[model samples]
Target: MDSLIKDAVKSGTPIDGADGLLNQLTKAVLERALDSELTHHLGYEAGDPAGRGSGNSRNGTTPKTVTTVNGPVRIDVPRDRNGSFEPAIVPKKTRRLNNINSVVLSLYSRGMTTRDIEAHLGEVYGAAVSRELISNITEVVVDEIKAWQSR
Candidate 1:
């Protein structure tokens, strides 16, 4: 990990951005986590002889784009032939990850408008989030608060 950080710095890779070292690292980590999930589901490591007679094997991975606190990361999610591998880290059919909704809510609580939050995401995290999406995230929190108050 130290070597990778040194190499990235030597190459002048930006610390944070859409195409920066952090984004690349996040992608690598998420893909690795997904692969680990698949291995746990299948009960064998990739290319292990123990999986020879296994009824279910690893299928090719499917590419998925998910939003994270770092930015929008494109990761190849591993799949299983049995079609039962549900990743706990990223999950299936879910795009946003890494508590990004929490970030939006925190900003909203600090009196940042949806438009301001949208721009902040784009500028800081390289995420091109729309105002509507930010508003929707905040609205969910507002509704939850309202429900809690009524109780």
Candidate 2:
């Protein structure tokens, strides 16, 4: 497999069997994996910003390092959007501080009490996320909720 991938890369073949790529299966799998990873990490569909009116409004640049359940991801945040486009993984305004979004959401969905969720988070991530904080995070999704409902 390694040799196949190396050969394909050396030949500059498109991974997805675009032209005449070798190890098409491996390439396809990798492509899908990358897509899934980006979706899981970005929390928004690729190229789907919340608002497309004014573009990303930010100062020179907003640098943030987020530690998701998967691992740490560093991203440059935009200052502002036309109105407010908060990316689910590292909310636009929040600047990025480890993705507790998934953790909080998962715990809540699993029927764990708020206190239990807080303790679990503290034990795993060394930070205690209060129920209030969790609620605040979730509140940001109201727009998404509305969109879903409308749909």
Candidate 3:
């Protein structure tokens, strides 16, 4: 993939426009971030001697597709035997990327109900974010909204 990027760069391929190289780049970066998060949560990197025969280890990965502005990106989410690790970059059972939180806020600010937003995401982004998930995501922005309003 590195070589492919290098070739594209050398060939003067434009980096941006729509459904271009940036989407793939975003996917790669997100996957790497998830892997790093897992490594940190485990307290031992994969293949480390300490993790060998330990009570828990990397079990495998589950394919998860996140909806991005670029489009849908499929990523292999790393898993552990204990299943205790919850990814901060993209939480479990949440299909949309964290980047879409702003869009969620914007829609909610426009007086869109949770159900409305949920259906919109399902139709547009192909994400099945639940009402509870929308509430949790919007709850974070509630504080931000208060702070901004006060200012």
TM-score of each: 0.61, 0.36, 0.56
User: Which residue ranges in model 1 land beyond 4 Å of their true spot?
Assistant: 1-7, 99-151
Q: What is the lDDT of residue 17 in candidate 1?
A: 88
What is the TM-score ranking, best to worst? 1, 3, 2
Poorly placed runs, candidate 3 (over 4 Å): 1-19, 100-151
Top model number, lDDT: 1
Per-residue CA lDDT of candidate 2, range 7-91, in tens? 6567676644324432333223222332333333334444666424433433233555544333344444443333343343344
CA error at residue 120 for candidate 1, angstroms: 31
Candidate numbers, best lDDT first, in rank order: 1, 3, 2
Model 1 backbone overlap count: 0
List candidate 2 stretches off by more than 4 Å.
Answer: 1-98, 148-151
Better of 2 and 3 by TM-score: 3
lDDT of 1 by residue, 74-148 (tens): 989999998988775576889989554556767989999988988887787676666754664555456544443
